[model samples]
Target: MVRLQNPVLKKELKLRFRSFKSFSAIIFYLLTLLVFTVGFFLVVTDFKGKGFIGPEMNVVLFTMLTFVQLSLVLFMTPGLTAGAISTEREKQTLNILLTTSQTSWQIIFGKLTSSISYLLLLLLAGMPISSVVFLFGGISPSDFVLTYAYMIVILIALASIGILMSTLIRKTIVAMITTYGIMLFLTVMTAFFVFVTLSVQTGFDGSELGGQKPFSYFFMAINPLIHMASVIYPEVSESALTVTSMDLPLWVTHISFYVIITVLCLWIATKNIRVNMK
Candidate 1:
C-alpha cells in the first residue's frame, strides 16, 4: 500500500514542481525578498558612520526579514494546498484514486505532504539569504529557532484551512478562492476585532493604559502575524519593566495549540474525503 501511494505522491509533486504556477510563484517570492533585502541594505549603507548596522540593528533586520517571509508563507501556503483535492477532481482523477485500496487518510496525507514539500523547499531556498543578517551579529540561534517555529505553526494552520476548503469545494477555482478568502477574513477581521476591543477596553483615552489587560489578547494568541510579531519584537510589550512578559510564553502556547488544531483539521479533511468520495 505504501508502495502504491508513493507513485501517486511522487507524480503529483513532480507535476507541481514542473508546472508554471509553482515556478512562477517561487520566482516571484524570491524576487520580492531580494528586492526588500537590497533596499534595506541600501538604506543601511546610507547611515555608514552612525552605527546603523550594528549588532542590535542586525537582530532587528533579521527579525523583520523573517517576519516578512513568514507572512508570505502564510499567504501562499493556502494556494498550494487549496487545489490539492479539488484539482484532482477537476482532472477527473479523484475517482480513479477512490477505486484503489488506499484509505482516505492515506490519500489526504499524501496530498498534504506533497503540498508542504514545495513550501518547505521555498523556505529552505531562503536560508542563505536569511543568513546574511548573521554577519552583522546580535541575532541569536534561539531567536532563529523561535522565528522558524512560529512560521511552521502558521504554515500548518494555513495549509490545514486550505485542505479543509478543498475537501468541501468541488471545483479547483472555487476552492482556491474560498481558501484565500477565509485566510484573509481570519487575519484581517480578527485583527479588526482585536483593535476595536482593545480600544474600548482601554476606554480610548489619550492617556496610556499601562498594566491594563490586552484587548484581543486571546485572538492575538491565535493570530499568526501577531505571534510572529511577538517573537520578533518581544521587547515591545503591553507594559514596561515586565521582564517575564506575555509575548514569548503566550505565543509558544499559541503555536502548540494551533499545531494541534491543524492536525485536527487534517483529520477532518480525511473524514470529509471518505464521505465525499463516490
Candidate 2:
C-alpha cells in the first residue's frame, strides 16, 4: 500500500538513528533491567543459602523479567508517542506535514511505527538479560513468543493513546502529562479497583466461593500487566486465562479489547488531524 511507504516513517527512522539519544536510552534501559535481574538472581540463590538456582527459581526470574519489561513498556510508550504530533505543531511543522501527499492514517501509522521501532530496540537490548533466566532452566520458547506478542499489543494500545493525546492537545508538554495520567489510571487504578472489589466479594470467607477466582478479574482484561502475568506465570494467574461464566478465552478477550481501543484511538486521532487540516 502507498500508505505503507510513508516518507515520514523513513525520515523518522533516519533521524532516530542519527541521534545519540536513542543509543543512550537503550543503554540506560538495559542497565536498569540487568541490575534488577542480578538482584533477583541473588535473592533466589543467597536467600535460600543455595549456590545454584533451581528450575522454580528460574521461573521466578523469568516472571520478574517479564514484569520488569512490562513496567518499562507501560511507562515508556507514552513518552515515545505523546509528542508525535504535538511536537510537530509546536515546531510549526504539523501543518506542513498535513499538507503533504501523506494521508492522515499514513502519518499516524508512520509516527506510531517509528515510536515502536525504538521500543523494539529496547526490547532486543534486554534479551540477553532475559535469556539468563533460561540458563537456570524454566522458560520455553513458546512462553517468550506469547509474552512478546502480548507486549507488542500492549505497546500498540499505549502508543495509540499517546498519539490520540497528541492529536487532541496542542502543547507537547500538556499532551505528555495527559497521556501519562490516562496510562496511570488504566494500569494502576484498574488493578486497584479489581483487587478491592474482589476482596469485598470474598468478604474474607476463604471457603464461600469454593476457592474459585472471582469473575471480577474479567474487569482487568484490558490491563497489560495482568495479561503479561498470565502469560509469564500461568499457574498464578489462571483466572486470567478464561472467564468461566462467559465460555471465552482471556487471550481472545484481551486481543479484542486492545484492538477495539486502538482502532478507536487512531480513528479519533485521524479525525482530529482532518479537522485541523480543514
Candidate 3:
C-alpha cells in the first residue's frame, strides 16, 4: 500500500470510494464470478448427473476458475488505469500535480496505486468463489496463492501499459482503446504469430521446441498467458514450451519480461511528464 501521505493517491482513493461505480464494481465482480462458477459446475457435471468430482475434474475446475478470474481482472484493470494521467489532463489538473512537492515518479505511481486498489479489493472479495475448489481436492493452497501472485504481476504490467498510453496519448478514450489493442497484441497476436511460424516451418506439424530458435521462444516469453499456463500446470512438458537450449523454464522468462516492461514503462512515463513540466 502506498503511504497515505501521497496526496495524489489519497485524493484518488477518496474520489474512487465516493463514486457509485466503485460500489457497482464490487457487486458486478462477485455476481459474475458466482454465476460463472455455478454455470461451469452445472454444465460440466451435467447438473450433477455424474456424482463425485475426482481430482482430475477438480484440476479442470481450478484451471477454469483461475482463467476466469484472470479474464475479469484483465478486462477491468485497463479501464481503471487507462485514464490515470489522461483524465487528470482532461480535468486540467495535470499542471496542478506538477506544482506539488512530489516528483514525477511519485505522481505517476500514486495514480497507478490508486487505480489498482479497487482491483485488489475485488480479488479479495472474490476469494470465496475461488476457494470452492478446495471442497473437491485437487488445487492446493500453494497453487491458489501462486495463481493470485501471477495475476497481480500481470495486472501491474497491464496497468503500467495503461499509464504509458495515458501519458502518451493525451486522451482517455484513445488511451483506453490503445491499451486494449496492445494487450490483445501481447496475448492473441503473439500466439497467432507463433502458430503461423510453427505451421510454416513444418507444414503444420506439431508445435515443438527444436533447434536454436530463440526468437520463437522470445515471443512466448512476452505473453502473460504463458506464465499463467506454467503456474496452472507446474509439471509442464519441456518440449512443449522450452526455449531449445535455454536452461531456465519459460515462465521465468515470461515473468522477467513483464518486470522489465513495468520498469521501462514507468521510467518512460515519468520522463515524459518531466519533459512537459519544463
Pick by TM-score: which candidate is best?
A: 3
After TM-score superposition, the amount by which residue 230's alpha carbon in candidate 1 deviates from its true location, in angstroms, is 1.2
- For model 3, state the Cα shift of residue 124 in Å: 1.1
Query: lDDT for every model?
Result: 0.75, 0.81, 0.83
Q: Residue by residue across 1-278, what tens digits does model 3's lDDT show?
A: 54336888888899998999999989999998888888877887789656678889889888888888888888888899999899889999888878878888889988999888888998999999889999989788999999999899889999999999999988999999999998989889987876665565552355654566665666666776766877878655265455344566677787898899999999999999755533
Pairs with backbone N, CA or C atoms under 3 Å apart (clashes), candidate 1: none
What TM-score should be assigned to candidate 3?
0.91
Candidate 3 Cα errors over 4 Å, as ranges: 1-4, 48-50, 203-210, 235-237, 242-245, 275-278
Clash count, one per candidate:
0, 0, 0
Model 1, 157-243: lDDT tens digits are 788888888988998789889888878866777678767766665534554355534445656666666666767676543331242
Clashing pairs in 3: none
Candidate with more favorable, higher lDDT: 2 or 3? 3
Candidate 1 vs candidate 2: the lDDT winner is 2
What is the model-wide C-alpha lDDT for candidate 2?
0.81
Model 1 has how many clashing residue pairs? 0
For every candidate, C-alpha RMSD to the true structure in Å: 3.6, 3.1, 2.7
Measured against the true structure, the TM-scores of the candidates, in listed sequence, are 0.85, 0.88, 0.91
